[model samples]
Target: MLKNIKTESFYDLCIEESLFLEENVEESLKYLYEHGYRTIAINQSINDDNLGAQKKSKGSNKKVKNSEVPPPIDLSPLIETVDKLNLRGFQIFNRLTITYSNSETFNKFIKSNHYKKYHLIAIIPTTPEAHNYACSSAVEADIYSYNPENKFTARLTRKMYNKIVQHGYYFELQYSHAIEDSTKRKNLIHVSHMYHSTGKSKNVFFSSGAKNLNLIRNPYDILSLGFLFGLNELQCKSCVQHTPQQVIIHSVGRRHGKALFFVENVEETQENDHNDLSNCEPQKKKIKMIVDADVET
Candidate 1:
């Protein structure tokens, strides 16, 4: 955890705060802060349907083609709100949530510089083809977020899950639905069970995805919900703690262009790695060893 962050277990997952009709982003954030949520990612949703609608509304006959990256929903308003709140040790991140329709959507997405502006990117594969692509190498995203109401269905394979994890993408379960209705709770549990059946619940993260502060659950309360959703005690806790931590680290990697581990702008030293055998070693060292934390650390 960062030095200023006080709440250890809470990462609010990702939410579309910009979509809220009457909620005060600042007040909602302050309420979250009071409840010990130290980090939150504000998501902007994107997909072909919405993207095309904008053009249609503008009366532009230009058919939506490839290499299209939707313009970001400005965060300046929310940022100003944060500044007004005068909160400290709170981490706010801009996130893009892409609902993929095809490889072209993702292909165009990665090529677009707009995505680079976000601290994190999440994807919802609405179709089986998109889901398979996400589990494969066709897309880039930190979190695989699917709402229970979306009723996502696909045959998940253990190998696919492992491959996605290998690429640093983790699965996310949004809890607002489960908190609201019994049917949503049952569906969420079913999804979790399917996820666990294919892959272990090790890196599964839980999110509130709450538009109103009333819908939000405390960090520990989330763990209790996870247990109801079929996670074990450790896995349940990790959903709020370990898994969210991984999401943050993964986001940093994307923002920094490390792709997980590569350090940027590292200068080569003139001296050899070993002191006494300085001359024996090459002038440029193959790698430098130093005391530091892992990319996630």
Candidate 2:
């Protein structure tokens, strides 16, 4: 039998952090769970300059440390609300999205140990050098995302897209921006076409990136909107389902080592144990069996 498996059909990995800070955020989460979303990631975005400023404010001349990194937002209240509502299997994750233009700052910040506090790490590169670093060297990150509302200075080439996918990183496209404004919608579509033409839409997933409850779209609506971004039906479904699942699995593997196991045919194992008992003598001392240490989260 499979153990510790989650088979949810929908995932939204980019709910903006601002929404969580709002007073009615609990209501927003309830709406998402009711609309078929089982997994959600609260995203907090930070830039290289901001990190530098924070470090300087602390009067630190040495290399940046984990203390300089922003701590994950408190979700205890949200968790309590979930418990009160008894929403089973509703998972929430903390995600960090780093926007970087300087390679040096990005490298130092990416290596900080505090990154382990987040369930997923994403990077947005604004320069050609930083873009190359993200595509080739940012192995610790799970997703590569950019702001669709603003024009990006770095161009995405087919080679860069392939390299990113080959490195096991998923591309995130935010659809809420498309629904919020015409200018953003135009820019999002343009970027989506870039992904289509350059990468054939491989390893691409759609996220809400919604700052408010009204900005969030239903999963089915997102599937329909996928076609406008040059994705076929299967690709659209994978964006909300399979691809996002893979991204979660990838993030888990990145945080914990890539070790997994499953127990199959439980009835057969029980039967074998029963049969072995008939031939074996009872021991006076208990047998201590030590298995390898479980993977730490």
Candidate 3:
């Protein structure tokens, strides 16, 4: 849908590294800004073990009732970097990727008070059960992430992928993983094929997913890379632009449990319509004569 709308530049929504960290804050943002990235996100990964519960639910699936949760990640460090670089129209967002092995853990984390803190929430489902949950309509997250480095034995059928795309779920393709190993590149291509089978490859979110400056590539270069991976021109282009924007929009809405408040093209109306009033002429003040009661009465 955003194919016609031209973007001056594209966004790298999944930066595996942090822009606020003392180790690479300056270099990361500088490289991204130089490469024409208007927006970037810092993604932190929390493993399944850290999901606050070691036990799984023994019964059939139902709405999550209650469970303890791990401590929330401290995002206070990234707060200052929100507008760090003086780059024009730059944005930095905090995102968290949680890994879950079972639906119970996923449910508990979703029910946490800390769920809404991040601008984006992504899930890394290591098992088929978790994968089902991740792809289901009941899951409320921006991205269902699969690492290119990992091997996937579970199959994602066409029906499941279609349903996921229909529910506005997006998948992330990390470039850093592809760059690190040839096996990962093959894995990425294979998975891309599965997703393309859905006929809604527009739901893909392509990103550097870089933890270091060396791994980062310009958005245009990534677009070229997408072409090599079997993505059509439109899908590749929207990967960095429209797809991520929609992800953020939906994630923000999910965070608030509703859409964020916004308004545009609001104009102030004239208190009285001068043009309508121009048709009327002011009437002369009515004159009244009072009887001289003081002298006669």
lDDT score of residue 63 within candidate 3: 28
Evaluated at residue 54, the lDDT of candidate 3 is 39
- Cα distance off (Å), candidate 3, residue 248: 1.2
Best by TM-score: 2
lDDT of 3 by residue, 1-297 (tens): 111112234778778644456776666677778988987778877676743333444343232233333344464444455355566666666787888888877777777666666777888898888888777768887787887777876678878887777666788888877887799988888888777765556588797778777888888888888875678777788888888877766665455454334233323236334644685755333332222111111
Tens-digit lDDT track of model 1 for 21-129? 3466667777888887877777777776566566567665334443366666566676677677876656677778888777765676677767687777888888888
Candidate 3 structure, TM-score to reference: 0.74
Which regions in candidate 2 have their CA more than 4 angstroms from the true location?
A: 1-7, 51-59, 62-67, 257-297
Single out the weakest 10-residue window by summed lDDT for candidate 1. 288-297
Candidate 3 lDDT for residue 142: 77
Per-residue lDDT for 1-297 in model 2, tens only?
122135366899999888777687778778998888988999988777676677768777454565545888777788788888888778788899988887787767666767778888888888888887787754568899978767866788989888888767999999999988899888889888899999999999999998888988889999999988999999999999999888877776566554453223333356556766897965343333222122222
lDDT: the better of candidates 1 and 2: 2
Worst 10 residues of 3 by lDDT: 288-297
The parts of candidate 3 lying over 4 Å away from their true place are 1-8, 50-84, 258-297
Which model, 1 or 3, shows the larger lDDT? 1
